[model samples]
Target chain A: MPYVTVKMLPGRTVEQKRALIEKVTDAVSETTNAPKENITVFIEEMDATHYGQAGVMHADKK
Target chain B: MPYVTVKMLPGRTVEQKRALIEKVTDAVSETTNAPKENITVFIEEMDATHYGQAGVMHADKK
Candidate 1:
């Protein structure tokens, strides 16, 4: 099964995440010709201190 | 950091996914006020046979 993980900052409402998962799943299914039921999408929200990018930690970046 | 999983069908160009990650990351960062570096995103692709939804396996749904 396709298990998709989306990590980003927090503060998203449940509705937003639900819409995102549905839209993303549909997009991937249509594009790849895969079954919708097999698509598994998950979202993770983290704090600035937990992530790092471009040689700078998120806490430091912001 | 937020760890997001995006499970979808395969066969997408790397560029499409790269853009997706960048855009999604930015959206989340701005919306949640989280740092960019802390966001961790991962994508997983699975065969129809490996996934199931609505009481039906993807292989059967397809």
Candidate 2:
């Protein structure tokens, strides 16, 4: 049982999230041969301040 | 390069989140022997509606 997590910036609409859940489930199921019903998808949305790159916070980027 | 994710209900304040990140990073570092700076921790707060257990959504539970 493999759980999938999609981490991204906030602001996606509910419909987009719904689609994302469906599609990612399909992909993971196809790739891993796991049953679709057994797959779980978690969407993790983070604010800019919570993410950083190369020692700089995303919120600080221009 | 080890990445850690903590998924839980949404309620903790920023101070708690800060401490969580710090402590989890330390734990991962100590166990994996990875440097503190090389460890990345992501805190994912999800609504109860998004989580389910034993074929039931958490929001539906009494």
Candidate 3:
């Protein structure tokens, strides 16, 4: 069972998300040989205030 | 790099989220021998409508 989760900043449209889910499902299915119906894709969105990189909070960095 | 993500139905308070992150970090650090500062925890919330099991979506389950 391959469960793929996409973590990204919010602001994407519904169409973008649909495409992302479709493409990721295809890639995962192809590489892992998991059936398309068996794969699950979860989209998780976090704002800049909740993100950090290189030991610095994104909100604080801004 | 063990990045931990918790996906659950929303409704927890901010304090609960803090505790979740802290405890998850501690557990991961202790088991993986990774430094606390090197661990990252992300909280993701999804609604029942977005969840499914056994070919039935949660929203449709009810």
Candidate 4:
């Protein structure tokens, strides 16, 4: 089973998330040839304070 | 390039999370031979309603 996870900031609306899951499922299915039903998708929403990049926290960005 | 994610229910203490990341990083390093610095660990906390098993939501389980 190919489990796909989308990790990003936490402000998307429900409709956006719905579209994201559908589109991601289709893309992964097309590339990996896995059935849509068998592909699991997990959305991880991270707060700015909890995420860091290039040795700096997102919350500290100016 | 080895990215490990630990997905579980919420409520672990900060010390527990610290130990978890350390132990998991070490284990992955030992198994995959990836350097400790090259490994990235993400912790995902899921509510019972957001997770399901065997076609049943975790929140619905008794």
Candidate 5:
């Protein structure tokens, strides 16, 4: 089983998420040939305060 | 270093999350021998509509 986690900013609509899961499942299945049912995708959303880049928190950006 | 993520339904308080992160980090470190700072832990929450089990969406359950 292949477990994939997509971490990004919050605020996507349900439609976007639905499409994302489907497309991502397809992509991973195509590349790895893992069964759709066997592959699990988890979406993680992080607010600016919790996410950091280059030692700077996203919330601290101007 | 090990990258671990805990995926579950939403509604956990910040204190619970803080404890979860700490304990999970310690467990991973003890088993894998990875340093604390080098380990990255992500908490992903899913709504009923977005999560499914046994071919049924969590939202569809009674």
Candidate 6:
């Protein structure tokens, strides 16, 4: 089973999120030979401040 | 920044992994209005035994 967690910025249409989940699940299923029903994809929306790179938060990275 | 983590069964080619990352990044960027560099997608491969649902481990779930 694949528990795919996608953490991105907030603000996505429900359709978009759903589509992403479907596509991601399909990709994993195809590659891993796992059944589609066995895949669990989780979408986590986070504030830019929660992420950092090179000692700089994502809100400040760019 | 989006820290997208894709956790699935092990056994994918480097090329496949790279492609998944790129595609996921693009999807997030286009939908979230976040810059590509700000998206950090992490791929984690887990044994089916590690994941469970309905109180059953994935290795045994399906």
Top-DockQ structure, candidate number: 6
How does model 5 do on interface RMSD, in angstroms? 3.8
lDDT for B33 in candidate 4 is 85
In every candidate, how many clashes are there? 16, 0, 0, 0, 0, 0
Of the candidates shown, which would achieve the greatest TM-score relative to the real structure?
6
- In the predicted model 6, the residue pairs found to clash are none
- The list of candidate 4 runs beyond 4 A from truth reads A1-44, A47-62
TM-score of chain A of each: 0.83, 0.91, 0.89, 0.90, 0.90, 0.84
Show what share of the native A-B interface contacts model 1 retains: 0.47
Worst 10 residues of 2 chain B by lDDT: B13-22
Q: Is candidate 4 or candidate 6 better by DockQ?
A: 6
Question: Model 3 over residues B1-62: C-alpha lDDT tens digits?
Answer: 56776778777776566667667777887898988778776666789888988988887866
The DockQ values of the predictions, listed in order, are 0.32, 0.12, 0.11, 0.10, 0.16, 0.47
Candidate 2, number of clashes: 0
**Per-residue alpha-carbon lDDT of model 2 for A1-62, expressed as tens digits?**
67988889898999999999999999999999999999999997897655543333445565
In candidate 6, the second chain superimposes onto the true chain B with a TM-score of 0.80
Question: Which digits, one per residue and each the tens of the lDDT, describe model 2 over residues B1-62?
Answer: 67776779888876566667677777777887888778766666789999999999999995
State the weakest 10-residue window (summed lDDT) of model 6 chain A: A24-33
Calculate candidate 3's fnat: 0.00
Q: On a 0 to 1 TM-score scale, where does candidate 4 land against the true structure?
A: 0.53
TM-score of each: 0.54, 0.55, 0.53, 0.53, 0.58, 0.66
lDDT of 4 by residue, A1-62 (tens): 79988998889999999999999999999999999999989998975544433323345565
Give the per-residue Cα lDDT of candidate 3 at B55: 80
User: TM-score of model 4's chain A, to 2 decimals?
Assistant: 0.90
Off by over 4 Å in 3: B2-62
Every candidate's fraction of true contacts kept comes to 0.47, 0.02, 0.00, 0.00, 0.02, 0.52
In TM-score terms, candidate 2 sits at 0.55
lDDT of predicted model 6: 0.75
Q: Compute the DockQ of candidate 3.
A: 0.11
